[model samples]
Target: MVQGVDSVRQLFFGRDDAENDLTDGLLSSAVFRPNYAYREVLSGRKSLIIGRKGSGKSAICRRLAAPDGHPGACVLITPDDAAGDEIRRFELQGVTADTAKSLIWRYVLAVHAARHLALHVRAAHGRRSSRAVGALRAFLRANGESDDARLYDRLRRGARGLQSANLSLKAFGIEAALGVNGASEGARASRQLEVLEDGVADAFASLGCAKTHPPLLYLVDQLEQVWTVDADSHALVTGLLLAAKHITGRYGRAVRTALFIRADIYDTLNFSDVDKFHSDEIRITWSHDGLRDVALARARASLGAELTAEQLWGRVFPPSVRGEPTAEYLFGRALPRPRDAIQFLNACRSVADERGGPVITEEDVLAATERFSRWKLQDLAKEYLVNHPFLRALFAMFENSGYFVTREVIETRFEVRRQALHENFPAYTDSLTPEGVIHVLYEAGFLGVWRGGDVVYAGGIQAPPGPGEDEFHVHPCFRPALNSLGTERMTVQQGALLRSDVDGACERLRRLLDRAPLPAPTHTETLGEVLSIETEALRRKTQGRPPTSAQLRNVATHFQTLADTLRQSGHVSHPVTRRLLDEARSLTRTAGGAIGSGQGSNSEG
Candidate 1:
């Protein structure tokens, strides 16, 4: 039987690589791993979830937040996901970094607490949770609830309507949130903050009176995004940590806050009381076995009852020419991150689709390397763009160069060109020196140093520094993406590396995945459409073109799904709910009409 994109997607078993376990509904999703890390965070023993990107940090937070038979409410605070809640708007113009961050964090905590407290009224029915919060309503008064669109929806605005008391509380929130004030005003707000915290603590303390009180789980994610601006980024993350630690300490019985942060960022961050924070930290790690399990789980999910986990993976990944399971040939190409494994597998599937083969062949696996490498290269750029603003120039330094280079050649290769720039310039790295540039590249996973015959990918301690460390090879995975020494976009396809090869490889990936029409999306605005539009957009983005017709179709499809989900969720308290589905389906119709070639269909998007 012939296999292609449709078969590959069918094998996905409803798994969208683009989605997080949270919105993917982790509670019911088969990717659930009831491992130690899950238990530790769920039990409130570890508040910090640290991992490299795509290592399942978000999954852990979403899992810990599962409300299925879980004792308490879960208020997930992904600050970036919430529109209108900019970190900048919360900052004060004239305050110490610590004070400004603390005040913003405090206000954020209070608003979320108020929102969750009211929403969790059902759990608090036999107890005085509502009364405890209501009694302190005066203290909880804040003005900014209206600005936060999410506050109205998630905050449970039903129990008490637009009464003066609720209005007063909102006003109080606004007052508390306006932390940009004179020193004296700041002091006054601090006093009000103390009272609010005391009230929340007291309310949580009284929650034990309930039949089976669930601990309030606050899953805070996307802390990396908080680094959007570094001016006081460190202070901002610190304040969040301190705020969670302080508040959760008082109400440990009823409150558990888990913060998901990037491992690389966390490793380099400096803050006050850092050790204490480190003590309770849990790292999200991935091993060969664990990642295999993840792949098997996904395969199991896709194949469902037709094949068990082992059977599905066995069929998909047979023995390769190397006399090893094709799984190793595929998975070994990646670092131990889910993103790496998933992308590698996707690339293999794409090649198999391109070949019209039901199963991935050895040649298909080998050909997929160039594209997979390109993805990792872009992944590096996107993830590190903020932290290392000048990383591109560093990457360009590798263009056209062959696999091996000495430290002197690397420094000489880029230094004369690099050192001319002002030290303060964003593109200039003073550390472009021999040792420094080597370490930076190693850490970025773009290059690896060699000791005798073994390659060292790590930049820290394990890095080969002594005698034979002077020479290294450009990490083979990165070779396909780098350009020729001076030209741009001219990728090396003639068994030689070029600067432009990486630029063009990902476009090929798009074609590989975009084969065949998608199945009919359940919700007009389903994740399927989003993935479709986004996938098509990837090629255009690389070519520096605008969104293509396929992308618009996807956008419309996604909007429809979202509208349907909102309607079916049955809790459309927002005014938009009245006509949300109609507007969404309208978009679906409009978007569906844009695509040509009979491409737009309920089952084809």
Candidate 2:
């Protein structure tokens, strides 16, 4: 239950990504969580695993692709940027975009299957390669697919062959290459592809691969690396779906395909056959208990100890942070995903280690919260950068503001920056509107809406914020980074009304400095900064919530003292001095009005 800094340092949560985690990090097949998605894919009951980034889609894909992980052979196909570009730019003159892309995907899967069968017949069946398998080997060599090449290279070759009718069909008993003289381009391509697929299917049937060996499991993951917000991207993904569905049917029980796609990208796809995929879709969701199990599993794997949740949470990490159970404080702040939980838990461990602790303390966890919050905030922006490039700009509206806000308050903020936002991202102007931005924020998990009694984020089956719905809370994951921890709503009382007067007074002072330059440049600069700092501090203190009446009187006294000092020092013009004094008196009167109206204690932030 207790360990030195060395032991704490040795305790690691796996890497953020599954690829690295499996190779050199703490993750291993032993600790893999065989969740519903993994089970469904292995059982061939579901082929689509949809979830947001960090929801463990890649973890399942990587695990399934490992040796001894899948019952049969496994092939993982992850397209790089180049392959994505090839898929996006691919077009056929005689076919719809969807059909055209589907053909390419089918071609890729067929090639991989052919290659697998060419070797499997001898290795698994323990017999001389059958004629069908030989034909597959010949087809592979004839098409330059015999050698190991990058996915992009293979896609490029396949696309060229399909588009120009250059594929070698002689392996299928034809004497020459496929010619494009008989049918339209799409028809010709489809027919040629069908011939190749049939050749592969023949090999599978001849060896009785389906009945003899486990079905070949094909995994397609990380499509988001090449995903974009365009029609071509949509077609690319749609084609993948169509191709995966076709593989299951075309090869009968010989081949199974699973596509791990981001939820945002998957939700954008629309096609007539979409309904048919309903049963095949399995969304990756993580519960708090699920995440805790994962953490404990990984902890045991890393530390070589079967630490219980009680020991891990109580001895390793603090039992409580900020008066809440440490587990709740940690998991409740993170997006309900494995990666987020891993990163947060690792951060706490790292902080404790850095402080030379035998075990993590409440201070360590609190310090880690700030660092984790900043990471999640920036990561949220990067996660949506491809689809929503203007996301980072929107964070400024929330910085230093309250975590809880109403639609009206957000709209007021948005209206101030509407024109500039449109100009900055003119291409996305349609989505830069107040409603559009709200939806984007909500969908990205930066903001959660209060529904019923609890706040619900975007990953659930809930609809987006409705027109009639208004209350929103920033996800706790991003609160510390934005310095927006206050959650109480400010009442519409005199303290709230004085908030604007205080802000206006500060703005007036800034404008006066802009208009009047003090005679002594250096001294003026020093004093001006001091005055500005004070004003800014007050403004931030009451930024998104009401200022207390006592706080306003303090501000009024500070402003009057500052104005009088500047006048005595002869660093300000008489006009500026008079304006400052007037503003100070105005704040004083506002503070008196707030207290006299019995509104001083009504508003709290």
Candidate 3:
């Protein structure tokens, strides 16, 4: 049966097992492996995990912390949760909670102490008899504390010890003791904080069997949440990450820490000092192919199906590939981000459930696509164009052009306006141009490029080509807004025909006629001259037949319409003189009878 059925609750619910364990679960489970990311972490490298929310960052963290066959190989910790616990347990030699805030140095020192303690515990194997443990005890005593001190006593607890103390920490109300103010006073406080951090690292080292085994791997998750809290929390989290980098670099043989962070927050944290953080430490992105494999593997696991990525794609979206499906086919025009693909499948599963079956059909997938497209567009509209007026105008123009505007068409409209009113406009009109507006729309996944050109529909925009492509298009949803803008600038007819009125057309024609400098007619002018030229040409074709009166009237009427249009639009420079002379002569020549034999045709005919 499909996972999510009966209720919307089930539809959105994800499997907890898939989240915690990597084997035999969701298709997404197999699709997402921490080994690649883990390898980087295990090598003492630092990197960023940039998937959107729910894209498996947390799952990857959990998996890395518990690699198969190496269950006791790594430590995973969240600073937000463990900070207060670490501080209180690693307070400076002469510090108390009241003066902890002043002892920033102790905090750093405590980290070292903590590291030493953790190493000691790992060496002792819970026996407290080894030389490392003895040396650590002596170090603690000499630095500030006595042998058999409570903190050292607790530090020796190890993984099982810490887990068992979970309730005790809660009962004693020491969980909140991990707060910033819990460390000791003065420069020693900095020392204490460092010691505390070191302790935590050492604890992790101990759990991962780092002392006698390979380097310990610790996965730090949810760094973004640090920024959401108060300033002190933010600083604490940043400090920890820096400390991890430092410790790993200085002690590569002993431990490694990999931090999984959101892409959006990576820059904000500003950990770019590669000399301090190491340039080789950062890994920021997962390629499209990598994400595709992740999605396919997860789907197979979730459905309990033994299928290759290709076969799995076929089962999920048979119509997309027809005979044999692939990840590219299943995702349609959308890029193969693991989260996007999984969410799509989830949406399809909802439709299938509503249809009373575990099976998802092509129709369901299409419906899901439509739903995602509309949702994506709404988000893009709000996020990108809600405030900028110029973008608003640009969007309006794009929409008016029926959503498939070429660069030339947009440039022409802008140029015409600029020439008419903004003659002093800057030269970089195209650079200051609103192409970015389209780009923003594209990035948000609302717009996509089509084969013929880019196209945005109710479903979403088609993907655009790389730079230097000939054509582009957009979604039709922009049509209404653009048409409205175009209507305001000039009437639809004016903009469409590139003329303000019939007068404008006539003025254009007059300009062309004047530029050619044709001779005026002997009695009338160019209008009559043109009519005579046409009549004579017709006569020549008809063996010297003259034009009929009916034909003459039709030709005259056409010219009069043109003159009237020109006059109305102020295109006729000498309208009154031209009208009086032309109208009178035309009336004086009114026909009284047929110009030819009853059965005869006119010369023009």
Best by TM-score: 2
Question: Once all C-alphas are superposed, what RMSD does model 3 give against the true structure?
Answer: 16.9
lDDT string for model 1 (180-205, tens) is 23345445455556655666766665
Model 1 residue runs over 4 Å out of place are 1-9, 13-29, 69-71, 81-86, 89-95, 125-131, 137-148, 151-183, 209-212, 306-314, 321-324, 399-404, 420-427, 450-453, 459-473, 482-605
* RMSD in order of candidates: 26.3, 13.6, 16.9
Give per-residue CA lDDT, model 3, range 173-254, as digits (tens).
2333232443333343343334444444444444444556665555667654434423344344455555555566444455
Q: lDDT for model 3, on a 0 to 1 scale? A: 0.43
Per-residue lDDT over 237-281 for candidate 2, one digit per residue giving the tens place of the 0 to 100 score: 999999999988989999998899999899889999999999999
Ranking by lDDT: 2, 1, 3
Candidate lDDT (C-alpha), each: 0.57, 0.83, 0.43
Local error of candidate 3 at residue 461 (angstroms): 23
Instruction: Score candidate 1 by lDDT.
Output: 0.57
TM-score-superior candidate, 1 or 2: 2
Clashes of each: 40, 0, 80
